[model samples]
Target chain A: MYKIFLTFILSILLLPYSSTFAVEVDMLIPPSDFQAFDTPNDDGKSVTLRWPSSPSESTEAEYVVYASLRKNGPFTTEVLRINSKTMYEEGSDSNFHYVEIKPGKFFNKDSDVTGGRSSYFFRLVMMSNSENVTVNEIASATPKGNWFNWKKLNNFIILIAFSTLVLWFIEHAKKNPNLYLRKISGLDAIDDALGRATEMGKPVLYVHGLNGMGSISTIAAVNILGRIAIRVAEYDTTLKVSNIDPIVLSVSQEVVKESYLEAGRPDAYVEDNVFMAASEQFPYVAAVSGIMIREKTAANFFMGYFYAESLILAETGASTGAIQIAATDSYTQLPFFITTCDYTLIGEELYAASAYLSREPLLLGSLRAQDIAKGIIITALVVGAALATIGIGFISFIFKAS
Target chain B: MNFFKRTIPLIIAFIMGIMMAFQYYVPHEASQSLLKVVTRWGITIAGFAVFIGAYSLFHLHWNKIKRKVPGWGYSTFVFFGAGITIIFGLYNGGEFFLHDKQEGTMFDWMYFNVQVPAGATMFSILAFFMASAAYRTFRARTSEATILLIAAVIVMLGRVPVGALIWEFLPPIADWIMSVPNMAAKRGILIGVSIGAIATSLRIIFGIERAYLGGGD
Candidate 1:
């Protein structure tokens, strides 16, 4: 026992050293001080880029170099993506992938991004090992200057205006809010669907999507389910909600129980009604779809984020001619839904449906704020454009003269 | 009405959201350091939520087994699968299959034999179902139907090798339809979608959307 304990202590002490691994990558050619001038190519909208590779590189499968206009680029912005090259094939190695920054691929878009005001920076990344792991940071011959667009005045003005509008609307909606969002047809039909299920003595089927938590659509579906559960409880109608995620299943159970208690029909609430169907996607789909067929559900509500399985569930419900109110944020599945379901909440409309159903003041207020923000953006664009066109001289002169 | 139930979680969520949003732009060390702490705490909380979820499942299944419900047999299967999976996973360095017993590994067997086949089957069924659905639904009874039918035919043919074999024009025509008309419609829908998302997010941020807080109307 003492020997074992000593060995454990010694191993624990040596763990950090055993695990310590460092990777260093460097470029050999043109050195760190190489310079390349921005020469106006005959192909007006083009600029050439060349970089050196690391000398003492290990057995790397390939090298990929990335370039951005800024040193620390705002990659989220569309401006930086105009001609972003992800794959830069290495020279001399036919098997190695490389980027040849030539015409048609990354230049000459007839935009205002020419005339030598653009600055570009490049980075070299090494990928080696069987797992295709990326190792060490490598730099290119510093950032270089490139051309710019003179006609970018309009685009700049529009961006400024839109930003202002969104900000203004956000602030305005926070105070003095008078927003009216339209009702969702699918949500409006819920009461009738639930009532029909009650009359027919059949369970109201609810599938709270097959997506994980960070999804806005899943949250919206859960919100709708809460309202539906309250109605079902009040009418003493049997409600079955099948979930793919265990977390979601637990939440659905709580939501159902709370709704029943709120409706003063706690005795009618059944724990088995809300269940975790399965973790695997198709299995969950088969189980839920099978349950719908077996139980002979009168009303089927498919709400939330869904994938290809959306069609299977929706079509199965359609075959039964059940009052199907299917809503999904997955754009690909929308075509299937629009053709099959009685009422379908298209894309963003599905996001707003829960708010409409639950007329909770916050949702209504937020909708109003968003509209206001959009209006503010439009106005800012108009004003910025007018200022930019009338004269950069006038705008700059005003600041300078002051 | 309690502070813990109502105000605290919302306040935390709002603060976290704003902090995360600002962290994208702010480069200060203090902000970055705080962001890391918040992120770690958030991850820990998420881990706890996972445990809670597993516990709920365990509790429910345990009750079913104890009561000897109608689906008690299925409960036994579930219990065995979960128990075996966990045991194998632990033995395989906290993975889902045994390391030493590669062929008989539970995860490899289930994933290959069950998950992959089921997923592939579901995907393959789509092709047959799409054909049947199109045949039944793509009648040119109305102007909309005619348009849809034409678009569907062009899309179906243009995607395959035979369309190029039949007519070179088919490819260009399909490309034009997809790029110009389809793109325009998709863009319009996208703009509307973004607007709705922004509106909804704004509502949530501004405390206008309480439906998520269990404030069911």
Candidate 2:
């Protein structure tokens, strides 16, 4: 009984040295400058383990990183198993081999990773031919989450400066609401189109192209729609609005309804006038094409973002002898619209539609702010090109984000 | 009444606008989680929006059918198409097809065999339309159009093998045009669009633009 008790005590005492003693051959040496530290700029789920490549390591040798919650308890989990060849392939320098330790699906209380709060013990074992040849001392690190991404600081600064410019312009415009904006001919001809629709005793068809509610062009289209709705209501001319998105359809209904109310012609507002044509791309084009042919709309307004369907819609409208005006920010689809429609709003012109139509000082102010921002961007580009030509690449580098 | 109709919505827009705008800068796990949650919420709302789309579609067609409009016959096809697609989807292509597991549901077969071909046909028609548009565009009616015509020719040639046979230098010139002048023009427009988008977003965020809320203000 005494011998058994002594054996138990010795076993408890030598538990730490068992890993060292269990090595069959001391052919390997522990890597120098071993470290375990929190991985920077990431969620607290991982820590980076680093060690300088050891001279004794060969292509055949394997690196085994054993992890445990306790400092000296059993390191049951083999967190990593990689050969020295792969570690060397990552970098030719004898500097460091890095392994980011993150827990997988089966991790539990023993791993003790409470999102950077837990400090887990990690020890390395160098093995060859399935035998432990060397062992490294345990080190601990806590994986942490950072509050801010320093990389996006440049973008943040630009956004802040631009916003400040907009607000300043908007404030200035309130006092002096006559912000000079170039006349967009497409928007200018809207009244004539409406007048023609009324004269011809035919409906005015408005198609919001294939864009979601979140798109800037779509919002601009909606704003334009509101203005058109008011004019149509007052003129007592029928206006049909076709939609591809349900949200846009819902919003259009409300916008048209309110426009009718504002025009004091709530009775003339038809719920079915604004409806979802189709959700899919080709279906939407097909439906809108059918509307153009069947209604024989005197005037057609195709606005927002478009894809391949731009031509089909415009061509069908053109065939019906309607005066068509198309506006979109999609540069790729501009050629098609320009060819088929009577007038096309290109690039930034589409964005200026609402401001021009509403003639609201606040909206015009935003437009002016955008123009000023564009001037700044143009100057920056010029300077950047000059500097790059002269071998002063600092400006270009500053603009480049990681 | 004004508060509920206008002010409340503006307040909500303000909160959402500020949150999403600044969320781009935050790298924390909590910030990422918030973005994911908000994105999921948007998707969930879009799922419910399907019903709104159906309501408008059915209402439009039903009106046309009821009134016996000129194209009323076509309107009925929309119903039959939707009904057939749904029924085929629910049956799962007979679900075991005499106790043998079929490759896919009838929905998949219908999509591939019927919808895909139909979509492809519509897409194919764009080529003819493109040719027509190209014919109109390539006409050198003005000085600007002449320049456009020349540029378009170069790009078209550069994309094909025959251009190299015509002149070895032609390909390089075309490449230079695309890489430098074309890229510069595209970037210029993109910058303007981005700035416009940002300004519009700010206008909405600050409650200066109420057109989207149907001009309740």
Candidate 3:
């Protein structure tokens, strides 16, 4: 009887251990609703997995995802490990979990999809700290591709609308060709500055800031250059165009040449008049500053986009007592131009300067369309603010970038 | 000649611009691949274009030196700088830029010790320029100038410890000025810039603006 009592006590101590090992009590339960499918709006290289809510935060089981090329075979290939507490995040589905399976290299080597659409088999595993584990059944899903990104549909719609507006305006302007544009003070000074340079018998220095042809500011500056070149050619005044970008220099040369030809003064065109000053930023500024000082130009037109070098150029030009007119879309540099130069084109005025100078139907049309678009945007902003204040917040989602 | 110089470029520009613009909305792998291909093409073309810049720079200096023009001595420095940089760069084991450039060479030494410091020095000069500019801007010559000066002083004070020492409300006032008024003005300019950019882009894509392609009808 004593021996039986000792055995009972020993069995009680080992009962928890034996039951855990022998009976195979699962440390974690496989979450329900576990399934896999194709990932949307991707390049066909990813799959997505979904499952029901995690068991409990108190349970220290980690959700391990396994992917296989075949169904019902060795499901040992691991994919991802998700914490149980992650599923309990605020606003997230308290009853559901979803994970995207981007099987890049692993499935490329061991995938089991046949001649049919490419498919992958996936399963969920719940593992505890004690090294005990449980798994859900395998589910198959296909990874697919789509042509258009529906997420960016709003952006696409805006682009189409704006393009149509611009084209329509261009057609209208072509028919009428008498569209009115507001006076840009800096542009107004352009002809006066060129004429002043002629009267003074000193060159007009046109400095294209350190931007390449890709920049819209540089393009606008070059257009303005064309107009200025025409005036320079007509007035029989020397014009100097300094550039930091080789491509811009090439284009400037051609533009100036064409302008001179159009002015019926082709013989007056000089290739050296437009040349690359320097490639590096500070060096370019230094070189142009040196030119301004040495030549003592009568007029200086600082156009295109500028960075910190703006102040240095404008300051040096101011010291030279040149009739300076500045135009740029870089608003940060506007204050410098406004303070030092005789006149400054702020923001959109720089873009509009080309249209205003050329008075071309196509460009003026585009500029007019831009003004209309700005009005629409302002209206949208006011409406959006009112809607948001009134508790309708979905309007903001329309403007959100995907 | 006109066709090669003008029409072909316009056609190519239109096709490329339209393709690139619309490609932003495509999620397919082919669209991405096309972008990569086009980017590589652009880089290659720009690589070839660099020679043009180098040629123009050298030709300008050469003409200056030939003419014995005033300040001709400065033109010689350009040649010296370019020559030294190129020679050392090649010496740094790039196989004349055919292979990877190794470190601990004269090229790296010149770039780190010379170019970097000079560039930094040039940038540092902007502080003095800013001070002078601020002085000019803060002068209360008009009603507008007075308002600007007050705002500048408030912002300057609120940003430092002395501001809190002077007045507790100063910081909040400065914050309001930056967050509300400053942000509003900046956003207005940004909106204008965006719309103007779109207008300019459309003009180029449609071949309406030909000045950038060297001024034509």
Point to the candidate with the largest TM-score.
Answer: 3
- Sort candidate 2 into its docking category: medium
lDDT of 3: 0.83
Error of 3 at A21 (Å): 20
lDDT of 1 by residue, A1-402 (tens): 999999999999987765543332333121122223333312222334433333323444354445555456422221111111233335544322233342224323343232533444455444444322222332222212223332343443543454445556546645645556666787788888998999999999998777865566777777778778888988888998888776677667877877887788889888877877677778777777877886789999988888888878877777776899988777778888877778888877777676666664445554554456556545644676588887644444322310
Q: Which clashing pairs does model 3 show?
A: none
lDDT comparison, 1 vs 2, better candidate: 2
Alpha carbon deviation, residue A10, candidate 3 (Å): 26
The two-chain DockQ for each candidate, comma-separated, is 0.18, 0.57, 0.64
Could you list the chain B TM-scores for each candidate?
Answer: 0.76, 0.93, 0.93
Which regions in candidate 2 have their CA more than 4 angstroms from the true location?
A: A1-34, A49-66, A72-101, A104-106, A109-116, A121-139, B94-103
Top-scoring candidate (lDDT): 2
* lDDT string, candidate 3, B153-181, tens digits: 99989989989899998999999999999
The C-alpha lDDT values of all candidates are: 0.63, 0.84, 0.83
Best by DockQ: 3
- Model 1 in CAPRI terms: which quality? incorrect
**Candidate 2 — which pairs collide?**
none
Where is the poorest 10-residue window by lDDT in model 1 chain B?
A: B93-102
Q: Which ten residues in a row have the lowest lDDT in candidate 2 chain B?
A: B96-105
